[model samples]
Target: MSTVPPLNGSWLLRGRDGSLSAYAPRDEAVWCRAERHPGLPWAPPRRIGGDQRLHAQLALGQGADGYAHLVAWRPTVPGESGLVHSTHFRPHLAALDWVPIGHPDRKGDRTGLPAVAVDAEGRAHVFARNKGGGVGMLAQKERGGWGPWRDIGGPGAHEELAAVTGGSGRVELYATTSDGILRWRQEEPGATLVPDEALEASVRPGTLTALPTSKEHTTLFFADLEGMLHAWRPGTDPVPLLLAAGPGRVSALRCTIDDHDCTLLAQRSASGRAVFAACPTEQESAGLWWSESGPQLPVGTRVALAEDAEGRVVAATLSPDGELRVARQKDEPGLALGAWQSV
Candidate 1:
């Protein structure tokens, strides 16, 4: 049996101008490729920044300005120390060099994979599991600097954390803990995030993810211990969605299809094929459906989903052999997907 790998972070990003940029970890460094337009061929992958083996998948977070922020956590070695670093990508400009964000610990390197979300004002907030199994965060200062790492509190938090900017411009965070789900919400845009004990559920740790459904609301999704998928939001109980065919992480993105607002999802199935599902935004109770969309992924693959400038949903997967497969939403009807293209 092929063992599943740790959950990889978001590797596909859509810039403000409708161009798509894909990133992957390779040869102790991160590589990037971009499309000038929707139907144009993707540029060959190019390595970005200096070489340092990443400890987890590269995390991409974009602000309202369409700038993509890249974050990664790397291990320390004899002559070097492990740390979390970040850089930003903007169209027509070279990517900024990776700047060390420091580890969660001042005297030690006990940090897990880093997750980041850029706020409306373009400040990048990065989160990682600390030495005490709690989440620590470092945010960009509006005046132009990085803030100190602070423990945001998640006593038994899992390493797979998801951070996203809500439609209202505030940032929200969700993490699966030993007890239930822990969430942090910003009272307002660029404000401090307050912690709350989210509605309890038996969430399979790495499968926890969130999709912003409205300016003030976001829906959380995860598989239960039995591989059953459920969707939940504040003030409501979890609405069971469907049974997942595997134990892989779920990637969800809010998009529009046939003039209707919808939420699209992608996950690697038990047989190693990438599968997709969709439903009207926040209407999982109405009806939700899933189908296989691409070729079998190599062992340990995670599908990343994003919406391009043309309002079509795009799914991407990076295989172990360094191959990138992409699929886009077809225009015909409900959640139809075009053939997978290897770039």
Candidate 2:
């Protein structure tokens, strides 16, 4: 398979294209390709949308119905940007013909990257930062239309939104405010979003990443300004799991192995290498272990982790030179990862 940089964020979804489709940004537009199987070469990349003004950031998710969803914004004028586009790929057709989702903010207002999550009923919830630094959301209507953007009050300015689905019909969201406070929102199927208090006690600003471990639990991960990685489960106290001791970021994903809950974390080390850690949901603190699964990655390299069709954990990283490298964990029970191989 060919390797490409995650210029606009990358996503892997099953049942699309050849049962596995990968999406990323190339040049001024987003592109995607797929493979029939994990070990096979990928098909040629196909451009998604957005022309000369396409932004370098994008969000992707897949719904229960097996449709791949994508969202992005494009610049319209100097100091003014408006258009927010949404698109999806039907596994049967294997195409990404985009359609415009009405802009939530005014024409000249700055906007953050869009985050999307799908509920049990196949409805998509999209969240983003509005001009006033509060969170705004749009819901997909059952009649195949998008509802108007509603301002969900929160304290976050110019921060990307992260969201994950919990249980059958619950969704949770996270975002960091300009002042360094991480806020959250939760909702049930067909219910309004209820804002929750700040999550981690630390007021140091940082990005948020989250995944649902089970119907009753979801895990949030973030690296503070000090580059220390923290994991928080809603009802429990926050834990500082990894210390970067320097500047870097963390990415994580939740998956199942042999019917056990598993989570994988990739953090950039102080020395500019990507380090990995794995632990079960019940042994978050006791069984936490690290491994050198791949070569040293450049600082700020983007990492994405997901379970392939065969239920093996697959980690993909985009290097500074625009190459995508992949590594997979063996089917065994330990936190062991195979060597990195170029996509």
Candidate 3:
């Protein structure tokens, strides 16, 4: 059984050189900490605060240039929230000041967390649930300017949206709605986003995850209303993979183990402990088994997975109390984890 550790969602960023920097939202501000090198201890945390009050978790997206792009919802008065963005130019460095990227509907109420994905040309596409229950998108232009918000309609859109840039540089997006799951795909790099009618997959809100398993193909994973994990690619029916105990956002990473392509998944179980599973990439028909990894986490714990500079899989967990813990892939046989390091 593989023992993959857990993290506090996708907030963990791995630089090109394998340095790790972790970010999280605490109250009205966001904080960051980083390790200068692969085996170095984490430096002290730094606060990246803004004037507005943050109402949602920070969403991170990295571009080809290795800059960390962040988006967060800041709600001032009732029914008035705006999205703010920041960029961490490099690991262990100060990020640019937070800039406002106003919400889709200026006065929209009940707006959820925003999703961001950086395209091949370094454009940051931002998606949020608008007041009309549809998705509103604002993307960066090729010339480094922000575009006007476009309502890429998805009625009854709920929770956080999922956007990913495939290895082919195409941007794909997924959103869960009252009726079913919705998607938007870019025809090519720098192309306009086109939405597909909602897929019939009955995914629980906030449980959707998109993992690019190949150069040009991506797979979608999520827990159904009954807590069953399913994997689906475009034009294919949802393939049942695991019977998770509850439904929540699942963190996934596509990497190779012993030269075999694998997709690893992590989620907080109903018991508040983190569990993991791995399978052949894009081969859900093969088979899978889940293993409990880290100890019980605090409420609102998020998990994330990434490969380090030495090609070792790393998992991180962030607790509600602002504690960040990490474990890396051990040097043994199948996927195993080293001791958890709190920093």
Candidate 4:
């Protein structure tokens, strides 16, 4: 049988245009600016709203009321470290038209990476990593200013946080922790953040996808450190074994557990081989869902280029052909690859 052809696309994008944007603290206001990209000559960056430095981990969230509410937390500098001095970034609204937000708070000297969630009424919840290396207080945004910052629960330690709209006035916060992923209630009675539960995955920075389990239900997916991924819920413990180990360090982890689509994409450092493996939980023997971008070519190290909805894979490498190469499963019962592309 002939090998099936997989999808084709460009190499992973890199350059100045890809620089990361961060929210920094000005004297009494927060400055939303671009900082970390391969090469964009930004003019010392710019400022926007809020008073404290927001964490870079807060990805751009949903926009509403003609404004994009940025969620961020600032860690305390070593000297002024304390529960009182640690957190500095306060949540605020940035107008869709590009108007700056709050005045910088000179008195507040501390901040950390804060997980942010905004509700239907534009209420924002800010959670931070603190001086003692624990999760910090929860703060909210009211009208044009920030309400007082309240301690959610140092008990529930979270490195990354995800917030989504749920029940009556309640917003939900999901977090990744050493013990597992956990959650806390917000916007209602018992809205205090506590240890919701353990996550199935054993790490942070995992890609999260929201799934609707029932008419009024939803779940999340996250990958662990060992290349394994898990399905999680706010109060329930993570369900493990969602995705088995892939080709390399989980450069790209995807879970369609809601659809049983447990495909993991990775790259091998030693062989410069790209792998696309299927991770079936019920079947222990499904083994690796892999493809070699250039096992035959002189590849120094493999870097995952991209993967799509159809389980197709692409990788980039420093080979004679080009930096970006192609790897796809052919119809011959195994995966195959062609030459590399310049882009």
By lDDT, who's the top model here?
Answer: 3
Better of 2 and 3 by lDDT: 3
* Native-referenced Cα lDDT, model 4: 0.41
Which residue runs does candidate 3 get wrong by more than 4 Å? 1-9, 49-52, 76-79, 108-110
lDDT of 3 at 196: 66
Candidate 4, residues 1-343: lDDT per residue as tens digits?
2221110111132212332233333233334433233223323434553344433333233222312345433445644322211221222223232222221232243444344444556555555554444555444445454555455554545444555544343555665556665665553532555554444556645344333243244456566776565555555566554453332223443334334644444545334444444454323246554554545434333344433324444344434222333333332432344554432
In angstroms, the error of model 3 at 73 is 1.7
Ranking by lDDT: 3, 1, 2, 4
* TM-score of each predicted structure versus truth: 0.92, 0.86, 0.93, 0.46
User: 317-343, model 1: which lDDT tens digit per residue?
Assistant: 877656788888887987777899998
Summing lDDT over every window of 10 consecutive residues in candidate 3, give the lowest-scoring window. Answer: 1-10
Tens digits of per-residue lDDT, candidate 2, 156-179, equal 444666777776556677777655
In order of TM-score, best first, we have 3, 1, 2, 4
What is the clash tally of candidate 4? 35
In model 4, what lDDT does residue 159 have? 43
Q: Kindly give the stretch of ten consecutive residues in candidate 4 with the minimal lDDT sum.
A: 2-11
Query: Where does candidate 2 clash, by residue pair?
Result: 1-343, 180-205
Top of the candidates by TM-score? 3
Q: Give the TM-score (vs. native) of candidate 4.
A: 0.46
